[model samples]
Target: MSEPGKYVLAKPIGEAEIGRLDLQHRMWLTQHHGLYSAPISKSSKQRVVDIGCGTGIWAIAFATEHPDSHVLGLDITLPQPNSAPANCSFAVADAEGDWSFATEPFDLIYGRMLINSIRNWPRYLKRCLQHLKPGGWLELSDVAHRFFAEDGCSEAESPMLRWWRVVFQESSRNNGIDIDDTYKHAQQMRDAGFADVRERVFKWPVGSARASTQEEKVIGDLQYQNLQVLIGGVTETAVQHGDLPGMTAQQAQILADEAKRDVVENSDRHGYYMHFATYVGQAPR
Candidate 1:
């Protein structure tokens, strides 16, 4: 019932959008400061594993940054740029299945945005802990579904919100996964026997930062556009196939058109924020 590896079926927004995948990857790594605190750390002392590694973008970058560390990017598909660093490699594997290839404990475990595929958080956390060496670090991040209004920027309730929520809830139910509460990821880490846990939240504004000062406005705008396409395409397909109820063709079209207008107009008065939360913890020594 679950399409395990299908992340997004949306069209690419631009080269910038293409590039942001790497940016997001890097931002995620930077946010997990504990894992990279040792600037001169040896790679041989650290083995890094990225679960649901996707295109291996993060894995490749990590390998390039830390040549001493062997990085393994494991996912269901091994598609990636052929020119990856020698220290970085990929393997086709399922996170829900046994991972015999990684009997040796790793120094770091990284996972991001794989919420929809993981049906059991406890099991997933246990697996992550088992493969992590004592005192190793686990850094995980996920996005909250609600795109919100940061104070002073108000928006009338848009159909996009309703439509996207329905699609996510329905799709997750159909896929045997409950929608994840990424905000509580720290709790999961603690339950998994992790120590020194920390969580940080990053908010991305919808358009030009005429308001929010902490983030790059243009990058956020482009990311907002890309997100519309991502969520819209999935919701449209699901609604068309009757996976979601109460969404008429006309409503779907209206929501899709509104989403496009939101990005194109870059409306400042109606500000919304995309929420990204990251959790980091160290395994018990």
Candidate 2:
């Protein structure tokens, strides 16, 4: 269990491996190519650390693919795994801590979708730098914008967009996160003395005719599902902060229903887009 005041529970990935969670994982894999791609150079003897590794899926995959490499997943939560490869291990660690377990430097460090949970980007980048071996790689990926919609599909006047903006802004404000920005992670890497920085952006077209298959539809579904989790918390915060009029529970439900339709209709009339950006840099040898 996570200590009191921790923003999240410190359980293993297995503990959180529910069906919806699995769907999110698959969608993320599809959305972020770098998560499982050839772009990453692998040395058999290298050590890799996955920061904020939830459920240890990515860590386990890396361990399976590179038998000689060591993979460690550190998170506040550790899912109880049916089995983990000999090369893979999961531990409880807070990203804001000293990272005391990493006595030696790691050859690669990875973090994904962690912006909303972190307060200080520069401090986090500095800590990631500290755990890296000379010439080690650091990769950071996150959603640049929330609730993307096609140009003029959902106008500023659209209730769905208005609800989303208010919900996201208030929730992020309450959580000490800057949701509007976090895309400039490349700049953060450069400031941390990392070199050879590169940034890649991927677009997950949601609710658009542009998506040609069921896989795309599944992605859209997952986006809406995850959005549901944030909506309540965000709206509650807005109401409490006096930023929004207190909406009845029914009103919340109606907004969600409308948003779902907007997402499921393949609205060529308008489309939803999810922005995924990744920044990769190398620590100087």
RMSD over all Cα atoms, model 1: 7.4
**For every model shown, what is its TM-score relative to the native structure?**
0.80, 0.79
Task: List model 2 lDDT by residue over 229-257, tens digit each.
Answer: 55555565555665544666566556656
Model 2 residue 176 CA deviation (Å) reads 0.7
lDDT on C-alpha atoms for all candidate structures: 0.66, 0.67
Model 2 is weakest, by summed lDDT over 10 consecutive residues, at 1-10
* Candidate 1 residue-wise lDDT, 1-285, digit = tens: 111221211122334324646545443433343223212224354698888888776677677766788899999888576678899888988988988868788888878887776778888888888888888878777776666655443335544455446565665577676555676677887887888777667665566655354344654656655666676677677666776566676766776677556655644545656677766778888
Off by over 4 Å in 2: 1-21, 32-41, 153-157, 212-254
Q: Which candidate leads the pack in lDDT?
A: 2
lDDT of candidate model 2 versus the reference: 0.67
Backbone Cα, N, C clashes tallied per candidate: 2, 11
